[model samples]
Target: MKIFQSTTHYNYDWEHVSTANWQKYSPWNEKTPHVIAVDTLSRHVDPASGVLRTERLITCEQNCPKWLTAILGGDSKSQVYECSYVDPKSKTLTLCSHNMTYADLLSVRETVVYTPSAHNPESNTQFTQTAKITAFCGGWQKIKNKIEQFTVDRFVENAAKGREGFEMVLERAREVFAQERERMEMSQRA
Candidate 1:
């Protein structure tokens, strides 16, 4: 699976924002060998303001490592940012920024678009220009289900294993401590 770097924003306020030039941030630079873009329309109501906002987020993908580190931070693992929309009506640009680490951004549960690989038809290439148009509603459902199941199973298994290992170590330590205490007691009595 080819993993491409991507930047995404979600607007949940009653405003329309447009990006003038994403390239200015140098998001495409670094180790990214391939670049792709996708956009999605969504809406949400702000609980505090009681304002409904429609947002169209354009996600751009790149394979450059340096660019990824600059945007997401660290050595480029994966990242996602839940940003507040800035209504700059003058510039027609919505500003979204987050104070998060690369790992934190990678943990955002955003929609993923899967595309067919051009270089190798058999490969399940995860990035493509066509992803913007494909119906992703159904695919996201499947991906979410699998992720939930896997995460639950992994945590359960690890927790059980950790408890068992801790018990074993505790038992061994108890035995050693008891023996040492008994020897000290006998020497004092003599």
Candidate 2:
């Protein structure tokens, strides 16, 4: 079995970013190693509780994880993630997730937190992502340490590719945020 944990961080607009729905920062990209498509299986926002629940199939268009290909037996490029997030009133949006498709193939989970800097709220928004992936492989417990290290090396490589994609997402989000602000201002003037 192979397993790993990784963290990533980025900055955005503190105020406008918090005002947007999480959809503003889409994870899909046409680039390598990024999700080829985001199939929204289900989505809902509870008006009473101000909670958003989203179920999506994140399909990776590129090559599958080598570990998954070697040990697992099915077409394993896509994974389902169930997410629960709250309103961003506090300039924070935290998402806790579960990988539904990982029932027997591999286990995956992530906690993504978005927060505005307390000291620089007007200018900066911080995004922190903490994620883990554990592949279920038979035997080789004695070599578990080596397996883990190798998986971590692979994970870091994949994460770098993902980061490049997300940076593109971030820049697009910034453009959307600016457009929203311009529209709002124009409406107020009208």
Error of 1 at 110 (Å): 23
Question: Which window of 10 residues has the lowest lDDT sum in candidate 1?
Answer: 126-135
- Once fitted onto the true fold, the runs of candidate 1 whose alpha carbons sit more than 4 angstroms away are 1-141
Q: List TM-scores for all candidates, in order.
A: 0.27, 0.70
Q: Give candidate 2's total backbone clashes.
A: 0
What would the per-residue lDDT of candidate 1 be over residues 64-182, giving only the tens digit for each residue? Answer: 35864676455533222333242333222332322123322122233332232344424223221110111122457666555445444443453344334433433444465579899
The lDDT, on a scale of 0 to 1, for candidate 1 is: 0.35
User: How do the residues 89-186 of candidate 2 rate in per-residue lDDT, one tens digit apiece?
Assistant: 55567766656654564566667676776656666666666666665656755465555566567666866766666666667777876798999999
Give each prediction's root-mean-square deviation over alpha carbons.
22.9, 3.9
Residue 16 CA displacement from its true place in model 2, Å: 4.2
On the 0 to 100 scale, the lDDT of residue 59 in model 2 is: 60
Note the Cα lDDT for every prediction shown.
0.35, 0.60
